[model samples]
Target: MRRSAEPDPSGEQAPHWWQRAVFYQVYVRSFADSDGDGVGDLEGIRSRLGYLELLGVDALWLTPFFRSPMADHGYDVADPRAVDPLFGDLAAFDRLVTDAHAHGIKVTIDVVPNHTSDQHAWFQEALAAAPGSRERARYLFRDGDQPPNNWVSVFGGPAWTRVPDGQWYLHLFTPQQPDLNWDNSEVRADLVETLRFWLDRGVDGFRIDVAHGMAKPAGLPDMPEYLRSVTGAQAHGVDDPRFDNDEVHEVHRLIRKVADEYPDTMAVGEIWVQTDTQFAKYVRQDELHLGFNFALVDADFDADAVRRAIDLSLEAVSRSAAPPTWTLSNHDVVRHVTRYGGSELGARRARAMALVQLALPGVVYLYNGEELGLPNVELPDWALQDPLWERSGHTDRGRDGARVPLPWEGTEPPFAFSEGTNTWLPIPPEWAGLTVERQLEDPDSMLSLYRQALELRKTHAGFSGTDIEWYGAPPGCFAYRRKGGGLICALNTSGAPVPLPPGEILLSSGPIPTTDLPPETAVWLI
Candidate 1:
């Protein structure tokens, strides 16, 4: 069994601010472009603080804006403390943080501790030094005729890349991102410094990228035969040698130590462990403050699948008494709208899921454009930029579709996301109907639904609880109520309409044609 963190001198542990807050994920480059450079930047985010406040999110989790070569779109960090010129400078980030605070929104940024860009000074020095030099100690390098092991890259290909010195280094994602050796004291200390650098700048928290990574298994071993071929969503299930090792807990503890130094700072990890016991380990009292449970993100639109995901997620976090985190879509995967079935039906189902998600008792992370009910775009081959595209020899179209720039206020390509006609990823012309400007004017648009739900979540007494109670419903529907509050949430995925539980209707995902709930619809009641 696990216990909560030690209580304060007052003898009661006050809930952290993030416990009940909704975090909006801003994939920096695709969010907004202030300079018409065809890419979004920190200044662009600072310009949009008002919109986020209006949308009612309590915090903003900005993806990597750290100095990087952009091989992995900022995941391959070259300098963890410096702001990438592509985004802005240190002064710009400080302004964004200060302004966001003025709007009552906490700001959290991504930290990629598992690896650094190959262009980093350390990697450059390692390349020039002898195989056994001190510079080589910072990363995972071993002399080998073959790759150090049979492990496969998450982006598709051998995980090891050989150098002219006849030594191979491990890069689990792309060659540009070399995995750091957590066993190296210097590497661990540098990560601590990185955390303090941003915390000292007043960041409210961090979204730790690949929190389950960093600690590699002993002897640089090959993965078991059965797990080698697993990739993508299924990869989390098998015990791949690449991630989720037992030693990873020590790395998280180091992060937590630094986070505790700053008042009200938090650490939420991007964990993908599937088993309840394994997942719970990352959020234990001494480890990450919270860990993302991706079961719901992987769930389909079916009622049973959604219910199972919810139940499993709750169980996983209950062990540590940590608040569970939920998200339907992110920059890495296919958007939930497209995953639910794509088109009008997909939008309807996505809206229903939002009600289901927001009604639950924990933190919610809404990916940008999700509130607009955005679906994945089918970009031409030339438009694909995800490393997976080239790494997979183009067989996998990659995540570029889900990362298309948001449609803000225009009727054509770029959709005013950039001043020029081009965006990093093109916004489809058909999205004119889904622009934020258009949605704001419509009383019944997806944006409207989210705004109303967020307002209610912030003010309604019915949302005041930490647990939920399941209710009996029809064959393809499920209902649950906040354990302490009287709020009730019901969803119907059946072929026909079903009777609603007796209560006042607070909101519905779609228009109710009668006194009953329609298929692919959800409702909140009190």
Candidate 2:
């Protein structure tokens, strides 16, 4: 059957498929378990398509589901061509692509090109080959008594691990996940082949993981002094020549080539860069479709800070020839409901933040459970599965807290995730009361507010328009105007009531205090 073409609403064809899209990020292990084996699978995600459609997302960004040993979750791919048995096989994946498209929602899978699990056949072959052999050169292998460079792993240890055969392999993450040598033409070719394998399956696009780390400095020099403080002997910043090396562009070019071969296929990069200008480089005409903006994710919630991020993002996209994308929370970070605050006031602040995200001029990513106002689960160190926990001596407490299983049913035994006896991550007790079933029935629940916001976004041109004008607000307040076609929108993020300049209030959070905003309240004016 011929594939259906993507709809281009505006006359100027959309620069990238993801721009203007509302993406729901699914942490596969915790989404749903079809086999009742205590783990979420592709079929499980298929069952939730209706729920996603109801929430009004255009696409879904699923975390890695490839064959893996699970050391660093699915990021440590042992085989890029096949799905892990634990998650489901290739046939199941094809079914998911078919099901999601039928619902008008695109599907993008996570692709970890920076590294591979030690168990991967490529790595295993390199390990067995003689030093300096063609196969061994595909990976960074050094025969010296020490590592080739002073780079450190982000997981808090030396980035190079010595093989028993007197050679060292580089790893930007855990020792089990060795970094790939992008300088090798064979490695790049294989990666392209792997990508094409999926694209041919009707998958819409890919979310490239740790994309900036694909290249290492050619010189492989010792760690620089400026990076010492931040590195603490760990991985350097993405811009570090040894990290986001210029050679990384070649990787993108290859990905772009593959994406262009198929109609409507897109590629988004998870680039950890400081400035939007630097981030812009990742989305040029020949690079990725969207380079996610981490500025807001790391920004302090304040009028000035928020305004700066938005302005910077706009300026960056203007410089780039491609569209932009934005996200708040993901599986790797603290939940927004907890990061902002855990009280009723905190929930209100989170709502305001959501308004800004949805109103931004690019694609927006929504992490799972955000609609239910879920907070990070406070799990004990013993239950943590993230390698960060083991490497940091439990001080960092890894990402397990934010990755708890979803609460579909309110009951304790299954937690609505599965009828199985074991779940990948235990559901937090507090989340049971905030289950999907319970929230769906409560009109004042966060779920309902999210549904309404999305509904408004679809109907209100101001919500999805790219044209924006920043409006100055009093201390501790944020205001912005979005105008498109004939629609206008004004938003106030302030604690005290601020007089509206005469417009209808389309939506509001919390009560307005004395004609001003109460703490953690936001209002949309038309």
Q: What is the lDDT of every predicted structure here?
A: 0.90, 0.79
Query: What lDDT is reached at residue 296 by model 1?
Result: 92
* Runs off by more than 4 Å, candidate 2: 1-17, 225-239, 485-495
- Model 1's TM-score against the true structure: 0.97
What overall lDDT, based on C-alpha atoms, would model 2 receive against the true structure? 0.79
Q: Estimated TM-score per prediction?
A: 0.97, 0.94
Candidate 1 at 356: error in angstroms?
0.3
Over the stretch 1-526, how does candidate 1's per-residue lDDT look in tens digits? 1113545788788778888889999999999999998999999999888999999999999999988989989999999999999899999999999999999999999999899999999999999999888899999999878887898888888889999979999998899999999999999989988888888888989999998888998987778777656555236444577789999999999999988888678999999776888899999999999899999988889889899999999999887858989999999899999999999999999999999999999999999999999999999999999998998888888889999888889677777788877788878889999999999999899999999999999999999989899899999999999987899999999999999998999999999878899999999999
**Which candidate leads in TM-score?**
1
